[model samples]
Target: MNDKKLELECLRLISDGSGIGYINGIATFVTGLLPGETGVVAVYEAKKKWQRARLQSIIKSSPERIIPPCTVFSGCGGCQLQHMTYEETLIWKQRWVEDALSRIGKLKVTVKPTIGMEHPWRYRNKARLHRESTGKLGYFKERSKTLIHFEDCLLISERMNRWIRLTEEFLTKGYPEIHTLTFRENDKGEGLLLLEGVPTKALSEEENPDLFEALSREGLRSVWGSDSEGNLVLIWGEEMFNQTILDMPFDVSPLSFLQVNSKQTDVLYAHVLAEAALTRAETVWDLYSGIGTLTLALAREAKKVTGIEENPYAVEDAIQNAAKNNAIGHVEFLKGKVESRMMKIEEQPDVVVLDPPRAGMHPEVVKRLLELKPQRIIYVSCDPGTLGRDLRLLSQGGYRVESVQPVDMFPWTQHVETVVCLNRKHS
Candidate 1:
């Protein structure tokens, strides 16, 4: 009930970048505070066990604290750890994985140091932003619909930033139908620009010429416009571009999943591949395979790799990618949820590799994995919370954690991508 300000020394950071502090034997989490810092806290929300507070002022701060470079750092939800030095950010991520395993997973497995980028800035190859009705391109403010229009973002690649400028200019010239814009560029300089417009509103026939002419100047490999239903109805150049990973070319579409940090993706996948330890005679099952990125990689080393994905679009791209990589004979793509399609396969795989989404694998999928009892299970996870929960279940089902490697895919954000390797217990 007290909104009165009280000074507290922050002890550590929680998952969402809030610092934990103790006041009157009760823990309170305050935003924008770092460990070893004394800050004046004002409680905004109080719960039974802890309270959420706002850092009013910092009387003392950590040595790692630094002024964020981005002009919209405080308001934009795009990046969270920009306030700290890049080195400190990596440290925070490593601690997060360790804490999640201990607290959430209730496991004592050792977590390795996080693999970070040597040059972390401007690494993002994909960006999703909102186009306001006022004809502005910007990101939504933190926890709010308010738009924070930025002239430049340090996280996006140089090509994406240029496209954003051209987009703003194009809108200023009178195109306000687009509600959301998602842009992606490959290392080869080819890019995909997707415009999502109001579903019910029909596009005026007269607007095509002017808009297409203006957009063509940006030199994107493809420009796709979709109705509110998200079905592509407009195409400029091509719908897909080629991206090379580990010297293997992939057909990357705007609809397909590609890691935003291309360089770190190779690093992360290399770790995953190493952890898989394929003997060239093991059958690999890649669950939630997107465009066969990992599936194709595993196909090169495994006897046969079967990929199960729900997105038919991505499956189409994955099939194409395998042919392009000349691994078609070793890999097959199936379009369906892993939980459902996995039950259809009669043969058991020697090794299973799954790169699940943030929510982690479905419970049914985990239950099935236990029934199949693959010798090795390599889980590529983006969210540690879900990874921890899943790990606990798998461990209880007789899987022993071998090692965990955390990769810093997003440098300035609180997000951490991890690869956990587990081996089934022997009788």
Candidate 2:
């Protein structure tokens, strides 16, 4: 591809943290360029309406831009917006939510300023690293398969960093079979390892004792691996990984999903509970409830709470979690697709809580909600673009947008978590 060089001035940042500049009515996207910055870029790929360019030289810079401290910040896909100040990033996240609501949903509503952490670094409790062919472990380059190793990832705790080093050193010896490593940590810094490839050697106490011994010595409570059939089996240690969220205990399996940021999950769930405002007489439904975290919380106030989930593993965990939390009597866990299980729910719900996946709600789910017509709906969303589209549908179906709160769950990244509350117009 022939490169065309052009001097561009970035007007704003896009959803992916890339700077967008307009030239001759066509948008040009250049990585590593911040808003209010002018840089000469090499336009490599040009389309009829847009172009992708590479930053060459910065002729001007934004006041909020700062030098990122991460060693692999320029190439690694783990974190974005590291070059911008944290305070400014929070402001932009709020604006992003406002933009999505107005431009996509066509709703003119006030969005509260983003809630940020006092100390944002080292807050992540989970990390997934890809293994290269030679057994080296690291994250991939942005939008590329090229693996880039990091000396130290600032997102996770120091304890996890040590575990990664130990595991990498052990695997580099000859374990070409393992291709991915996932680390999950609890609030106490206890770690769990999940290896996602078949091992040439059996990882048992009798066969390879050193690997487990070293990891166990370093505070790893368990090790799990996927079989050839893709089912997770406990290779060693405890069967379940334990985590405490908002004073409630949870048993998480490798296949289950939990929030990556431990501290912000508390903040996010507290906001959800506050917005729910459930009473003893009210009934609530938690759709897409994973491991029953929010469902159990709602059970404390609601007369009865039902959690609908499709993943059988997550449903099993949620059932056990309800028992562990002593809310088994008030909470019910249904194992099936939410869009299908919702049709069978006999009890009328006073409030409905939705924490759907990043792809957002299915159209049928939205239509069902419109039919059910719950008095109050509290939606927890991770993607703003999808949230806006669903909100537009719900608003058209007779729900008024009450409030939208954006939480900085993943700081130094382009992602955010938002909680929205809506009320039926008749109510």
**How does each model score on TM-score?**
0.95, 0.97
- lDDT scores in order: 0.86, 0.90
Model 2 earns a TM-score of 0.97
- lDDT of candidate 1 at residue 167, scale 0 to 100: 70
lDDT of 1 by residue, 1-427 (tens): 6779999998988878878988997899987888899998898888888888888899998899999999999889678788888888888898999999999999998999889999999898888888777678898887888989998899887767888887776776565667788988788766787776643323333556655555556556667776655566545666568888877899976677888889999998899899999989999999999999889888889999999999877998999999888997889899998899999999889999999999998999999999999999999999999999999999999999999999999998889999999999997
Number of backbone clashes in candidate 2: 0
- The number of the candidate with the highest TM-score is 2
lDDT of 2 by residue, 66-116 (tens): 999998998886788899999999998998999999999999899999999
Model 1 spans with C-alpha error above 4 angstroms: 1-3, 198-218
Each candidate structure's count of clashing pairs: 0, 0
In candidate 2, list every pair of residues with a backbone clash. Answer: none
